[model samples]
Structure formats: C-alpha cells, structure tokens
Target: MRHIILFFIWLGIGQISYAQEVRYETVENISYVDETASAYAKEQCKLDIHYPTSGENNPVVIWFHGGGLTGGKKEIPDFLKEKGLVVVGVGYRFSPNVKVEDIIHDAAKATSFVMKNARKYRGDVDNIFISGHSAGGYLALMITLNKTYLEAEGLDADELAGIIPFSAQTITHFTARKEQGIDEKQPTIDELAPLFWVRKDAPPIILFTGDRELELLGRYEENAYLKRMLSIVGHEKHKLVEFQGYDHGMVYPGLPILVKEINRLVKEKE
Candidate 1:
C-alpha cells in the first residue's frame, strides 16, 4: 500500500510536468514565393507558422492543408497546438488556374522557407517533419520522395525527418490525370505519382488511410501497394494504417498516430 501511494505520487508529478504551459506565437501570411512567380502564386503562396516561444531546439512539423490542391487556407490545426513543437501551415495555388506541377513546386519552396527560417522560431532544422491530409499528403510525399523538387529549392531531400501522410493518393493525382483527359476511375502511375519515386533510401514514411470500403476508390490499396513496393525496394521504415470505420475524411482519427510517429522518429534522430 505504501509503494502504491508513492507510484501515484510519481504519476501525478509526471502529469504536472507534462501539462506545464508552453507559450507559443504565430507568424501569419508570410510569402514563400518570390516576384518571379505568377501573380496568383504570389498571392496564394503563403504560410502561417506557429511555434513555442521558449525552447531553443523544438521539433517542427510543416503541415499542408488538404483541399484537393484546388482550395484551402493556411491553418495550424488545433490538434497540434501547444504540443511542444512548431507547426508551419502552408498555402499554395490551385489546379485549373495553375498546373498540379506548379502547386508541388510551391510546396517545395515552402519547405525550403521553413528550413531556412526554423532557427528564427527556435525550431530544430534537423528534426523537421512533413505531413498533410489528402492532396497535401500527396505534396509531402512528392517533395520528400523526388529529390529534384527540393534540390531546386536548395534543400536536401534526405534531411527531412519523416513523412506522415494521411489518406494520400500514390497514383497520379486524379485531378492531374483528369486535366490530361484521363478518367479518374482509370488509375495511372506515372511521373507525377509518388509511387513513381519510391526508393529504398527515401526518408521514413507512415501512411494512414481510411476504410477501404468507404474511402475514395482504391485509396487504401494504392498506399498499400506503395508500402509493399517500398519494402520490396529495401526501404527500412514504412507503415500503412487503415481506420476501419472512417472514410476519406479520417484526419482527426489519424492525427494521434501522426503525433506518436513524430515523437518516435524525433527520438530516433536524437
């Protein structure tokens, strides 16, 4: 009974330490693109960064909002707030107005900005993570898997801490293929596809998908195949998770898993 009381006391102390408030601030509407970019891109290519005011080297996660690459404002998700890490919410131009390739270029540029400015926000550049839902996830995979994109942005792709995509498409994004006169039902894996860039040496990837029965047709299967291919190519770290009852809109259920993986990988890096 005495030992049990002491254990409870330790638990209470741990909780108190964990709950200690960590003050944070937001820097909003910073343009990630330059004057050479199109007027629409200059207007739309912005980001909002939220980071803890204290801590010299907190881990940072650059989050891309999901709007199918056509629409969505920059936002720092409430789920990630005050979690002792920096979160950069990125914004980029959309399709039909701009090609999907342009949107990906914007993503790479935003990541480069985050890396260059991480120190200003007390973030650790070596521990940067990329994550997003749906189309945002697709961009994360593209920038991390295809080195040339980040190379063009003057960032090393291999320096990324990890990639945690929530319900991303591994095939050529349907919207992109649609622009090319291909039916969404007829899937194709080409140069635009994340599957096209899978390599054994790419950064760790944790893929989350919603229920196969309810998700966008073949979404889970597509990520599963990517995971299988990553393994076949001898990639050492990768995961595929499916939420049994959720559909394509499963970001909320998947956020905790993302956080857990962030912690795990951050520790490994340390």
Candidate 2:
C-alpha cells in the first residue's frame, strides 16, 4: 500500500513538471527589408525571434535597441525569457549612413512583417506590443502615433496591443535635429516628433522613464508631458511610470514591469 502511494505521488510530480515546462525556439536574421531598398538597409534590416514552442495565441513583444539613432544592435534581454511570450529583437539602418526618417521606415517595415507572420509563431496579431530603450523607444512612439509609416506597408498602427517606451524622447529626436545642425539643448516638436501625433483613439500606451533627477536630458519630464497631453486629449489607456533609483538605462528594472503589463493587458483582452 505504501509503494502504491509513492508511485502515485511520483506520477503527480512528473505531471506537474511537464505542465510547467515552456519549450522555445530562436530564429535569427529574418529579413524584412524590401528588395528595392539599398544594400546597406538589406544588410542591417533583420530581426531575431524567440518564441515558445507551445501555447497558441501567445503575446509578442517587439524590442528596439537604444543608440541615439546612430548606433546600437538588436538584442533580446535575458530578463524577458521563459515567460510564455515571444520576443523579437529588431535591427535597423543607423544614422549618418541613413537618416532618422529612413530608420523609422525600416522599423515600420519590420513591424508590418511581424504582424503578418505572428500566427506562424503561434502569436496573436492583436496582442503584439512594441517596446524599446532610448532611440528604440522613440521608434516605437513614432511608428505608432504617426500611423502613416505602418500604413505605407499595409499594416495599421492602431492594431498594436500596446506601446511601452522606456526613457524615450517625446520631442523631435535630437539626432534628427542634428542633421540640420541644431543643438541638442534646443528642443523641437515638429513633424518627426511623437508629440505631433497624439490622439485619443490610439492603442494603450505605457511610458516608462527613470527618476527625473537622474535621467539624461529631461527624458522623464518629456514623457511626463506626453502622458499629460495624452490625457488632456482624452486618451484613457495611457500610463506613465518613473523608476525611482534608475537612470537613462532603465531597461533592466523595466523588464519585469513590462511582463506585468503584458499579462494584465492580455488577460483583459481575453
């Protein structure tokens, strides 16, 4: 009788272990750039996808890297792994070699590709979230608020599940202004600024920034104004969070918050 009880207990433990396992796979360098685009773009415009092998209709987070629009490589942080989600790290052409406008276009093309192929990876197009640090965050806001960029590639920006930009610029990116020899200290909100396209009807947005005193170049204040304007304009789903002890490099602490937001938003949708 005791042996029989032990056998059943072992079986239950094995079942539990199997149920908790999350099998995943990684696919690298899947090009989303057009054939007509320049060779440099084709070389740089690629994405790396890491997804769970199980679970249908899973959520996907598309991550952009921060390098002030002139540098930075696509990277999937380890903090986001093994969470029953798909994370895509995107690579795009850099500045000086390519203008910031071209980079935004590349990001749009990559997002369109992800939306169209989500199902192949067992992901939901409606549950796709866009996120990134610094310049990458700027890309997320630009492609989302402007809409025209995604529309050019036959995808609607409004279809995104959420936008979570970490320490991003709401004004015209300083890099863009630098092209015209404008100083970084002098801010501008022009056609390229995400502030230029704030609307009430857009998808849910979460702006994450570091402590105001520690963040670089007023990043936290910029995002605060963005949240305020979004609210003033009637956007109900927008949220802004400031990490107390973190600085411009807030992605580490922000990753867990992202997961929480993902689960919260995705569950509400379900």
> What lDDT tens digits, residue by residue, belong to model 2 across residues 41-96?
88999999999888888899999999999998999989987788889999999989
- Judge candidate 1 at residue 151 and give its lDDT: 99
TM-score of 1: 0.92
TM-score of 2: 0.95
**Clash list (residue pairs), candidate 1:** none
In order, candidate lDDTs are: 0.92, 0.94
Off-target runs (Cα >4 Å) in candidate 1 are: 1-21
Stretch of 10 with least lDDT, candidate 1: 15-24
Alpha-carbon shift of residue 139 in model 2 (angstroms): 0.2
* Per-residue lDDT of candidate 1, residues 3-77 (tens digit): 999999999999888667567899899998888978898899999999988778888999998988878888888
Question: Which prediction has the highest lDDT against the true structure?
Answer: 2
